[model samples]
Target: MSRVQCPRCLRPKTHCLCPLIPRLDSRTRILLLQHPSEVNHALNTARLAALGLNNAELIVGEVFDDLPKLLNCPGYQARLLFPAEDAQPLQAYSSAPDEQPLLLVVPDGTWRKARKLLHLNPLLAALPRVTLAAGAVSRYRLRKAPGPGALSTVEAIVQALQTLEAPTSFEPLLKPFEALIDGQIEAMGEEVFQRNHGEGKA
Candidate 1:
């Protein structure tokens, strides 16, 4: 028999992470575009991010037909959170209280899938790009990072929010993400986790 799942958080009833998800408000709006394939993945961090932030939205699809409405949020300058040669560093907005808060458009998928998202949505690609500063680390231990600054969807959102809104910590948003990781580790058993992905392993 299948286990029941929480209406929110979507974790199995026995391991529900709803209690840890926060409903924090942010000046900057977040729009997470997730590939359909990622919806049912065991670690659907994008859903966690959407639930935790009052100003965020999560949409699942390969091609977004409503890019016009999605990117046209008033009082917020829309910026794609993807690295590019000319992308502006996110830290630039940290201290700019006079400037408009961003409508951060993030693609939640693997490297290739995220690229596909940008490819499919020209308007999404046309938005000015913003990137996190270098040397940031990922807290997700279960999977190999695709690159140096790779982070899970929730982690990336937290980092971006914290950077764009300095002094207003968004660390609380990560509570459920951390819990989910711990649960995965516990389920894997210490011996297997240590042998495969423990300290200095992956």
Candidate 2:
């Protein structure tokens, strides 16, 4: 089988239709601590989210040896955007007053991979967990969730930031995600039509 490069990003891209990623400045800083394995995935939205925000940083690794240093950075409050049983929703923490900007750290990977990162990295676990509201669909169609309401890293970030009353610039960042989803649907529809008409044959 021949691999087709994505017409947009020019990468051997998957059908992930997220649009031209936008870059916006936000008061809440976003730090996406992604697993190395997630970087190459065509559907990875963390990369797209990072492209949309000026204060966002996407770091790839299995461990964070410099966790303390990152936490100590000036004008930043570090919090992990993970949904734990005991964790509070992002809105609760977002309303808290602080002179510093909020640093939202999200782990991007499968359930097993994310769990491994959390387990192997004690520093990450030390941070307070921020959860989102229950009952949301995942934007990623390629991966199956271990359970319901498991959101992709990008969706989690957007939801969390919205709770914080993040700047209006964030709206632009969401456009790419919409574009991507729409594009994927269109592509899939075309494929289905072609197949039904026997035009997809070699």
Q: Looking at model 1, which ten-residue stretch has the lowest summed lDDT?
A: 90-99
TM per prediction = 0.96, 0.76
Q: What CA root-mean-square deviation does each model show from the true structure?
A: 1.4, 5.8
Q: Which pairs of residues collide in model 1? A: none
For model 1, the superposed segments whose C-alpha errors exceed 4 Å read: 92-98
Candidate 2 per-residue lDDT over residues 160-186, each given as its tens digit: 777776444355656666666666557
lDDT of 1 by residue, 1-202 (tens): 9899898878899999988998999988999999998999999999999999999999999999998999989898999999899999887364555688889999999889999999999999899999888898999988878789999989888989888777789999889988988999999999999999888985
| C-alpha positional error of residue 181 in candidate 1 after TM-score superposition, expressed in Å | 0.7
TM-score of 1: 0.96
Candidate 2: which pairs clash?
A: 17-180, 18-180, 19-176, 19-180, 22-52, 23-52, 24-52
